[model samples]
Target: MKIRTIVFLTLFTCGSLALLVGSWLQVIPFTLTEDLGFITGALSVWLTVVENIWNFPIGIANDIFFFVLFWQAGLFADMGLQVLYVLLGLQGWYLWLHGGKNKTSLRVSNISPLELLVLVLITGIATTSLTFYLQTLQDSAPFWDALTTVLSLVAQYMLNKKFVENWYGWILADLIYIPLYIYERLYLTGVVYVTFLVMCLFGIRAWLQSRRAYA
Candidate 1:
């Protein structure tokens, strides 16, 4: 079978399943159509398969919808990160389209040593600061919220450069978020991230293969 055929089948299957779950959960307050978040999620996953730059647009849409939901849910950290994601998405689109030193830098590349170190350090300091501050603001589970927020910021920055490390960040955050969403009765979101977890694993493998091709 062609690789294209398999990819389409996988996306279709996942998307259809998410639709079913969304219908059952009725998680969104006023919609019977495909949940915007789930739809964008499936689009983002599909875009990852082709390494398309258009994932940024889908991600932006996903972030907006989620911003509203998270704000209402009082997941303040996640809510704030969704806004950051919009900015990050725009940055990623710009970078992907024109980030090359000579305006041609879209090739698959591994994370550089210096960049990785900086990313880790930034994540640590930002997470610590956000957690401490939010705790003072009486946010529930400030530490966990900060952890997800920091990881997501790191992931978004990496994504702007088309880095595969983005998936690793996403995987960790999704793992933490699945239970949190379930506890909050955000059943559709819980299921969405569960699917996102599986896709992140696939995305890592796919990006690694592309990295090897570049090598």
Candidate 2:
């Protein structure tokens, strides 16, 4: 295998093993709030690792897991986001396999200026709509949650298209999520978002490498 691939696998495997053992042994508390389940919490962190590596299949799995996780956490918007992630993930898998040159597998591609503009517009509209709806329902951190939710939706869509800008969106959302989950008292989940935020930096670098390879 290539050096980068080997390094990624080694780090991913080691980190996952350490985290899993820590959780099983109750080393890191394994939990921060009853707001989230152990498995759900575990998968959330796992999602960050796989996504950073641009692994779409595992992304699909974690997206499904989060669908259940967010639902149980009473995060209806996030639960809905998982549904969209799963749907788009399926499309992403197909595209990655068939959306490439001459109907071969798709390669990493850049977003056009038009798509970037659309992403911004979509973020604005979704955030506004969710903010109003959530406020009416008196949900906790409605604006923050709405903003992160919209950003996450945009990020997931960008990931589906293999757009490098997705990493930036993810970083923004993950930062917001840390405090949002903390407010919900899901401290472990909050920490997981912290990990996600850091991995997003690595993800940006990895995607940039991919872009360079294609360019």
For every model shown, the clashing-pair count is: 0, 0
TM-score for candidate 2, please give it: 0.79
Model 2 spans > 4 angstroms off: 2-28, 31-54
Number of the top candidate by TM-score? 1
Q: Compared to the true structure, candidate 1 yields what TM-score?
A: 0.85
Q: If scored against the real structure, what TM-score would every candidate get?
A: 0.85, 0.79
- Assess the local accuracy of residue 53 in candidate 2 as a C-alpha lDDT between 0 and 100: 32
Model 2 residue 17 CA deviation in Å: 4.6
Task: Give Cα distance to truth, residue 139, candidate 1, Å.
Answer: 2.1
Across 112-168, the per-residue lDDT of candidate 1 in tens digits comes to 989999989998899899999988877767988999999988987887787888888
